[model samples]
Target: MRDCGRTRWWKGAVTIADIKSSIGELYAIEQLARGASAVHRLHPMAKLIATAFYIIAVASYGRYDAGGLMVYAFYPAVMMAVSETPCRFLLRRFLPALPFVLLAGISNVLFDTQTAFFIGPVGVSFGVLSLAVILIKAWLSVTVVLILAATTPMQDLACQLARLRIPAVLVMLVAMTYRYMGILSDEAHAMFTAYTLRAPKQKGIAMAHMGSFTGQLLLRSIGRAERVYAAMKCRGFHGAQRLAPARRAAAADWVFCVCVCLFSVLFRVVNFSYLLGRILV
Candidate 1:
């Protein structure tokens, strides 16, 4: 009985720790954006455009074509290394998007049994290839966006969106959402901490309490936002979000954007992986 009690507390600690860590991760990304790397200095609109084109190219690959898809990894890999973003941090952020991707990709393995190729004595099926392609694409897509977010401040990115003629309402909505995410996370973390302290022997809040638990978190966050809104308005804050003075994209920014997009398109059409495989043989 003592052992069981100790185990519950240990698990509860871990759960609370995870919530705290999530709050840290949100701030960490914003902190990294303050760096002065070449990638960081590129005009936000240019980076946004380049990232969009890269994602479109990545999504164009067919489900069964893992060979070509494998070669598209260079964009994220080079971007992270050049931008000096932490690979492990980016990988951790990549995980929350994985479960649904895994659910969909795993089905291919069971449903697709026709053999497409053989590695010596081992046979590989189209389903297996498709699954591999899906997982790789998910990682690539997530990492590329992370690269963009890690290097660009939210205000700058939001301003870029506004400049690009993204609807002002939509831009403001997105900016507010991004700004409030950290606040909400902090509120949730505090609630989680309170629960663990009061119920020290439980591994988590009781399943029956989960709805109320979540509701409480939502209510607290809404209240906090209301207070903050009132405080800001008292200080002569209107609805408009002011951004830094706009700077036009430089010659180098154009060169970098055009080069990356062109390479992405070229890579989409040519299977560099197949070429390398043949050369090795």
Candidate 2:
């Protein structure tokens, strides 16, 4: 019984470590992408506009229309390739969100069971087709978000959000959270490392001690937030977070937007599955 308890404790610790490591890696990648020269030339608001439009189109499409969703994949693929972001990086970032989408899709499969059409030897049921549509929508939406984040600096993105009538408080929270998340993550990692160094073989810390540890972390974070607020006040920060002067969109920005809008509309309106059926006959 004691051995089983010890194994479980270590398993929990390992899982925590894996989660932290993944977060740290993602943060590092974002920082690197933000510093890339190409990203500096792109207007942050343009990226924001493209992402917003992509998401809106995806949401407006019918849930059983897999053909529409598949056509939209080209948008992200083209953007990803042109931005020089590695396919591996985007896949790694996007895959973490897929399981939740799949789980939600399972319910759609169980509930909507009307037959839609036949493809090859397979009879496409409404349930399965709907599930596939949901998955594709989720995937494309996530890709758009990732591309936006990769291309735009966090501060710039926050500014764009603020301009777009997102609540000031929510924007501030997002901006501040992104700024301080790295610090908090580092602190958490140090604490975990110290704990492991001292108690590697111990089954687990006592419940009372665990509570105390959490309290300490919260107290430290509160203190840090206070200090940061004081620093901001000293720097002449008003109620609004003033950003650097905004830049006008370049010709490339207009061209990019027009192309994306055109392709997205064309794909959504043309039912590829129906076209394929006609071609086959």
Please write out the lDDT profile of model 1 over residues 236-267, one tens digit for every residue. 87977666777988999999999989999889
Off by over 4 Å in 2: 9-16, 35-40, 117-124, 202-209, 276-281
Candidate closest to the true structure, highest TM-score = 1
lDDT of all predictions: 0.86, 0.77
Q: List runs of model 1 lying over 4 Å from the truth.
A: 1-16, 232-242
lDDT by residue (61-166, candidate 2, tens digit) is 9877776577677778877777777778878887878899889889877888777889998887888988888888888898888877777778788888888889
RMSD (Cα, Å) for all candidates, in order, is 2.9, 2.8
